[model samples]
Target: MAEKLGTKLNFVQKDLIKKSTKEPGRVFTVKEVANSYGISENTARA
Candidate 1:
């Protein structure tokens, strides 16, 4: 994966990263992340 562009991370982004490491090879989607983290799809997309 490419280096994260942003220096600071939102809660969702941070958790997503943590989840990714725990579940390597699993793919994530905007909708799935948003629903799991209680954020909106737009937030996840950004």
Candidate 2:
């Protein structure tokens, strides 16, 4: 059987990291993060 790649955080995580700063901390919920990056909530958690 072929091996499957593990799920990974999407663009939202990248954007969140970029948007987050020492001041704001860029903390966000899975849903919010998913919506921000146009990905599914489950994918966001991954």
Q: Provide the RMSD of all predictions against the true structure, rounded to 1 decimal.
A: 4.7, 6.0
Q: Report the number of the highest-lDDT candidate.
A: 1
Whole-model alpha-carbon lDDT for candidate 2: 0.68
- State, as a TM-score between 0 and 1, how close model 1 is to the true structure: 0.71
TM-score for all models, in order of appearance: 0.71, 0.54
Segments in model 1 whose C-alpha atoms lie over 4 Å from true places: 1-7
Best-fitting candidate, measured by TM-score? Answer: 1
lDDT of 2 by residue, 1-46 (tens): 6554333544555556667864485568888877777889898888
RMSD of 2: 6.0
TM-score of 2: 0.54
Kindly report the root-mean-square deviation of model 1 from the true structure over all alpha carbons: 4.7
Q: How close to the true structure is residue 22 of candidate 2, measured as C-alpha lDDT?
A: 43
